[model samples]
Target: MTPLPVRIAGTGVHLPPDVVTNRRLAETLDTSDEWIVNRTGIRERRWLAPDLATSDMCVAAAHPALAAAGCAVRDVDAIVVATYTYDQPLPSTALIVKEALGAFRALTFDITQAACANGVQALFLGSLLVRTGAARRVLVIAADSASRVTDPEDRTTRVFFGDAAGAAVLTGATTPGTGLLGWDFGAELSYDVEIPAGGSRQPAGATTFADRRHYLKMNGRTVWDTATRCLPDSVLNATAKAGLTVDDVAHFFLHQANLNIVRAAMDKLGVPRDRAPITVDRLGNTGSAGVFTVLHKGFSEGTVRPGDAFVVSAIGAGFQWGTLCFRA
Candidate 1:
């Protein structure tokens, strides 16, 4: 008997055409390009038009991945869309993506309120389903339209976010450690410190709108500090579970949160700066799409190679954090 394998068939990414530079942002906010770049490593980011939505970018990314994998839309057995921003509350963004991609036969579902780490969480779940015979080819898409929740006057988040999507196709295989090797997940619910008002606790209405609770808010210093201390341990834990050392991995894909966080985590893990792949400088923080976008950029630029072991780790709201080890 052969053990089922979860192999990544293909990867794709999509960024909107609108590029919002820090210099451009400085025109309205009380901030400068140097300040934003020095802190976040973000020079610019993509933004969608007012008419465009999260599912639009997701479908765009998924189509290329499906084409690259030589699989038609019908070949997808499941579709998992990781997003905090949705086109609507009901029917799910997953169904919208499936319909747009023409995946008439796919089992589609949405994973919501997952910030930067949502992509990996979706991948982990999709991989398990494939390895367990629950599905065959699963399309995992991470997308965000954070501009909707952003307050243009608030320079902190306005300078850090952009709209984008990324996708990967996971399929059953016969090889061990071919795709996801191991995963580690942790959440500090004590710091559900960031939220916009669309919930039972604060339903959408005129009062909430007046309070501006529907816009993004954060304790940046707190989240950054927590991420620095937690991410390296998450990486180490995942590597240990997969029976590999940190030195054994070829490429490290950290979430594109900030330059300082990456440096701090690497210092803690004792991993060299040269091993990490980063794209926050040009793409900004793409919410859940950040990790996969960086990984895709690495692959395109020849930073990643075949048969090489790699690790991807992310920390964000739930206050969630997670890691996934893989063989490329």
Candidate 2:
């Protein structure tokens, strides 16, 4: 029997109200706004208040997404959250989001692999659930408050992350070939970027806090090189698998990791600059939420239209990367 085609029915996003401009960081840090902007193309980023958690952002994003899909919370059969910055370690953040949204019937879980690419990964899984008839409507949410884990004094990692959440509703597509075309995911398994401690391998302790081992650590150059090479290849492979070419794609939704890396991938794929919409300048890198946030903004602005061919791609800390092609 032929399975149903999965499509993204609706999308929504929530960026915290509190804005932190580059100039604001310059007030206490040794760096200036110009330095941060020139290096990262980030002028400002949103930071959630201490009181809010990842699940809060997820709920905020999910309501609008479900509404847009013409689906009620009770109609959803599954909930998948992609995040590394959960409010707690034991209970999955997806369960908390489910409770907040009152999605009582949904099977809830979290995807922690692929770090920043977890959004695309979750979307892929949601597609599978709907296509396989295991779910009727699946809510895929990606949220992060990287500011909570960032080392304030570490300018490199601190200037690049922000707090945000994005959600999408997936269901069976009525139009044939009007949903996901093809997708690919891969990992290079390098620790060039990682949080050194707080996990089971290196449990958190007083010394961990003293040494700042819990903060994110990154080798920017290594990431730039690996992502630049791997991302374009992933896109090409997925497009080929889908029997399409780069020229057929009308919009590109690459991850908002860094402007320079995005530009590099565009150049490699021979995609024109205007074809890809970027959000890193204003939102910073919202971890797994980056791609979904970009997608939501594009849809809201009418930049991504129906029947348009678009590709979404990302690479994260674990050297994980994924690319998916879709027809809107």
Candidate 3:
């Protein structure tokens, strides 16, 4: 299949006001700031208020992205929302965001279950729609309210997650070979990280809720092993497929899963750490919003420029990992 040329015109992010610091968690859990920082490299994270939902962040993020791209709500051809903790099960999260943004004319797509890698999945769809001429302007949003699902009392899971949303506007690139390029995606079935209930396999019920079955469960060591190994391998494979190497790329937007994981990928690739920016230190692991936040930072800071080669990569729950290469 022939690929279409699509470029990211703009990027944006929305972080809730409430900051959950390691010290704050230490208040409730038997952990210390130094311990959290040394292990996860996360000092603080954002948590959405009880009144707000993931869609609210998506709407907030969409406005800046649309403005940055010089496009309006009515002009957007599609809206792709990637999330796991949707507001509810009945109504689609994408539809909720579209209504809020007043982007009624756009088609909506919901990409749930990819967790941290949802952003890459949404990007693939956004690029496809633009390349096929099915949409001139595509709004891609990645958001997750891990605050809504994780066991709050469990320090192991709660300390590593935060709530936030990130968005990007994709449009056809005028320059040839300056859009979506090579990619690599792989997955292995594993319950290393997962939400155990609320689905058909374990239906939501009084027993499920009472037993605390409807919550996020994770195997931290398994996640660390899978991520450290796959993130770099995926990036290398994707870059090589694009006829480029880590040295040839100017910037790398990697999943904000862990600061150490990012460093490991850079070390494995033998590239300077500055080539990949860090946000996990401040925002923690924002699930699907992780990679997009890095992308937003790079674009807003003017770190990514025309003719620059860049790559976005992520590993999510379900042991899924992927990388997308682009020529900026």
How well does each candidate superpose onto the true structure, as a TM-score?
Answer: 0.96, 0.97, 0.98
Q: Best candidate per TM-score, number?
A: 3
- Please give the distance, in angstroms, between residue 197's alpha carbon in candidate 3 and its true position after superposition: 0.6
- What lDDT does model 3 reach? 0.92
Candidate 2 lowest-lDDT run of ten: 1-10
Please, what are the lDDT tens digits per residue for candidate 2 over residues 192-279? 8999999888899999989999999999999889989999999998888777899999988999998888899999999897888988
Q: Please tell me which model should have the higher TM-score, number 1 or number 2.
A: 2
Model 1 has an lDDT value of 0.84
State, as a TM-score between 0 and 1, how close model 3 is to the true structure.
Answer: 0.98
**What is the C-alpha local distance difference test score of each model?**
0.84, 0.90, 0.92
Q: Please provide, for model 1 over 206-296, each residue's C-alpha lDDT reduced to its tens digit, 9 standing for 90 to 100.
A: 9999888888887788878889988999999988888888999888889888877888899899989878877888888888898889777
Highest-scoring model, lDDT:
3
- lDDT tens digits by residue: candidate 3, 95-156: 99989989989999999988889999999989989988899999999999999998978888
Regions of model 1 farther than 4 Å from truth: 1-4
Per-structure clash totals for the candidates? 0, 1, 0
Better of 1 and 3 by TM-score: 3
